[model samples]
Every structure is written in structure tokens, then in C-alpha cells.
Target: MGKTPLHLAVTGPSSVVASWILEKDLGLIRIEDVLGRTPLHYCASAANFDLLLKQGASVNHVDKRGMAALHGVCYLGASDLVACLLKWKPRLDLRDKTYGTPLHCGVISGSIDVVMALVEKGAPLNAADANGNTAVHVAAKLGRHNILRLLIQQGADISLQNTNGRDPEAIALDAAGNVGILSILKHKRQDSPESQSILNIVDEDTKASSLDNQVTGNDSPDFLWDEDSMGAAEQNELMGLSQSANDDLYTYEEQQEYCSTTFPKPAPESQSNNGFGKAAFCLPR
Candidate 1:
């Protein structure tokens, strides 16, 4: 509630007014509201956010909740705002009071773009929150199949367990019986380099035996292939299986409905509250 004129101007609809306020008193950029959020923390508009950064706003400033501007932008799924913050090189792994990194916030916001940006900027994918749940665990528990797949592809540790001793796969199964999510998790584990190496060893052993059988003119076939082994075609099918299942599970409109119904966006008034918004801090702990 103690926001300065600069805070109001930056978050206001007009970027010109914000520029005017900055010109009048550049030090206002460093002023903190009652919640400890500087003007940068409330700059939802990418233009305004960039203006504050160029004007020397601190991207590292945290609100009372221990969330920096980067954390808030990531939670809002504002890729544009995120890009502005990234240029300033903020601490990507800065932990909020809830022990969540920006990667965790991005995952919960359901924006793959935000998640990818943070990942590309070197955010810790396997950073565990207070509950020992990584971004992978949160995505699984929330039935975010696409996000989970991205996390897996980005080298997130799927085997990490939470306080309840539940891994990502276990959490996925508990999330409304999300078999699609479970399948993706299992596929990731199976496709690991270690797993592939073991499988290759077994395949070579079997292939050698088949060659010996063929040389001895045994009744068995000249070549024996393990049905369990995945070929190029099988790999392609497996890759597409999740997408096909997702199509069957949720259409574009239905996905929008699901996200809205499950995680409604905060009201406009709430966006400028002491914290960024309820959604910004409502992440699973």
C-alpha cells in the first residue's frame, strides 16, 4: 500500500506517464512499497519493465515473500517480461520463502515458454522446494503432461522423491489417474543413457547367439530381434503417443477450460496488491 508514484506509473496503462515520473525523480525507482517490492517488481508491462531496467532498477530486489521480479514474471507466464529480466542477468535460482526457484514457478504457471527461457538461462531444473519436490514433481502432480515432458527432456531428475516419498511417476498416477503423464515419466526413465546401455548389452548378447544358431543350421531363425527393443519406428510412435493421448484427453478449447477452471487467473486489482498476485505465491509447497 506504500507504493510510490513510480510504482503506479509503471503498472499503469500508459508508459509515457511512467517515463515522466522517472524523469521527475529517478530515485523513486529504488523505493520499496510496504511489501518490499520496488517498481521493478510491479512492472507487468514489458515496456515498463524494460524501462525500469534501463533506468537502473534492481532485478534482484525481492518482495516480502522473498520473490524477485524474475520470480513474479515467471509466475505470471509473461515471457516478454521474463526476457527483459534475463538481460539483466538476475539470480535464476533465487529461492522464495517457499523454497521454490523461478523454474518451479514457471512450471506451475503452465507456460512452456517461460520454463524453456529459464532453462536456457541456466535455472536449476532439479532444484527441490521445501517439500523436496522439484519442478518435475510439481508438473506431474498438476497433470501438466507437456511441461513434464519438457522438464524430462531438459535433464530434470525424474527419480527425485518428495517428503511423502513419492517420485514424479507416483505423483502423476495420483493426479486424476493421468496415465499419459505416467507413460511419459516411465518413457523418460527407460530412455536414459544407463538404461539404453544395459539394453544394448542384452541385444548384443542375443544377436551373437542368433548368429551361432544360424551358422550351425539350427531350426531357429537366422536373425533374432528382441521385441522389447525399440526401433526407429517404435521410437517415433512412442514419441507421438503422448501427443495423440493428449489430443484425445484435451482439445484446445478443453485445455483452456481446464486451466481456467483448475487455476483461475487473479483479478486485475489483485495483480497490484502487496505481492504480485495470489497466483504468484500460490505455488504448491
Candidate 2:
């Protein structure tokens, strides 16, 4: 890992020793390990992380995985560490290898506080990842009802679709079968000002067409929701859309396992500021 003494001292058992190492040589603050992780990148202790920052540690340095310290802390749901990083004004919307912003990581970690902090700080809410899935898509796909609600309240676009053309509503229904999430999205879309404006326009257009049809005595039949209305090919196409939505999602068990291994719960309060353990190296997937 090519960890220097400064890296070891900060992530080690003693914050006092880490401070001593920093005081001895400030240049160690900028040193990178074999993985290109600076001492700031490995400093899990909020106090130690702050100390390095005060000594001019670079917060924007990305490791081999194209992740900065903000990415790891957000994924770990470490609100304190996240707070420290935010004070430095690190790039709010920096994209990782997967093109996911820090807000996406916070949502994946299932930490409302982390998500709130990012949102309050003005992180881009609608930025999509490489797969065209925005924060809304991720929250819905993972069955995060509360997170989905928060994102919606903060003005995340619910109608945005992913690479497979499945929006959050379809993802909630087909991928997770989350009725609550679907209801929230549906209600937001219907009540949104944009949707209301579109509805009004559509209403006006319909009224004009109805008057024209009445004057011309047009007797063409309109499509209805009957068994004969949809052809075999259209039915097959609808079935394919549902199947594709399901195929694009991970199974519930798989999602749980991924969260467990990829974003370990924050360290206990007793160990919170001690050092980095499983929470330090959350690489982008």
C-alpha cells in the first residue's frame, strides 16, 4: 500500500502521534501511498482529519479508484467526516469511476443525515450516473422510501429514465415492487407545477379537437382499454419492458450483501475518531 509514516500515524491508534508526525514534517501532508491515498484520504478520525486539513492537506486528491475522501465518507455515512470535508469546499459534484456523485454515495449508504447535508450544501440532485440513473433512480431501485421522499421534496426529477428507459416509477414497481415509493412518485408528478402546466395545455388541445370533431361529425373510434384494443405485439412489448426493468435490478439479497460489504456501518462512537478500518477504502464499483 506504500503507506508513509504520516499515513500510519493518522490512521493508527494514536491521534497524538499523528499530530506529532504532522508537526515534524508538513510535507508529509501531501505524500501519497502506493494507492495514491494521501494522509488525508486515510484519516478516519474527524479530529485527525481536521488536523491534516488545517496543516494544508489536499482534500481533492483521488486515489487509484478515482475516489476522493468525500466519496468514502459519504458512502460510509460518516456525517462528521463529511462535515469536515464540506468546509474545505471540495468538488461537490465530482464524478467517480462509475460517474456517481457524492450524493449518490450518500443515498446508497442509507444515511438521511449524510444525504441532507449534501442536499443542503447544494449538490446537484439530478445528475445521472454512467447508466443514466440519477439519485431518484437509485433511491427507488433500492426501495429507499424515505430517501426517495427526501429527494422528491428537494426537487429531484422523478421522470428521468435510466439507460434502459425505465423511470423511477417503473423501477419502483418492477424492480422493487415498492408500493409506497410508487405512490410518492406518482403524487409528486401529479402535483408538480410542471405537470399541472402540461395538463392544462393538454386540456386546451383536447377541447379544441372535440369542438372540431363535433362540427365535422368525425365518427372514428377512439382507443379504449379493452382486451381487443392491444395487439399481440404490443402486449409482448409491454411484457418485455417489465422484464427488462427487472433484469436491470439486483435481487434484494444481492443488494443487501452489496451494501453490507461495500458500505460498512460507521464505527462505534468509542472508535469513531480512532482510525480507519473497513470504512476507509470504499472504492467505486
TM-score for each of the candidates: 0.65, 0.64
lDDT (Cα, 0-100) at 80 in candidate 1: 86
Candidate 1 displacement at residue 154 in angstroms: 1.5
Question: Please, what are the lDDT tens digits per residue for candidate 2 over residues 183-222?
Answer: 6776776756555432232235564343233323323211
Count of residue pairs whose backbone atoms collide, per candidate? 0, 0
Q: For model 1, name the residue pairs that clash.
A: none
* Model 1 lDDT per residue over 190-261, tens place: 746455432232234564343233233323311111132335454332211122444333333343353356
lDDT of 1 at 157: 88
Every model's Cα RMSD, please? 17.3, 14.8
Whole-model lDDT values for every prediction: 0.65, 0.65
Candidate 2 global CA lDDT score: 0.65
What's the lDDT for residue 38 in model 2? 87
The list of candidate 1 runs beyond 4 A from truth reads 191-285
Candidate 2 regions off by >4 Å? 12-14, 191-285
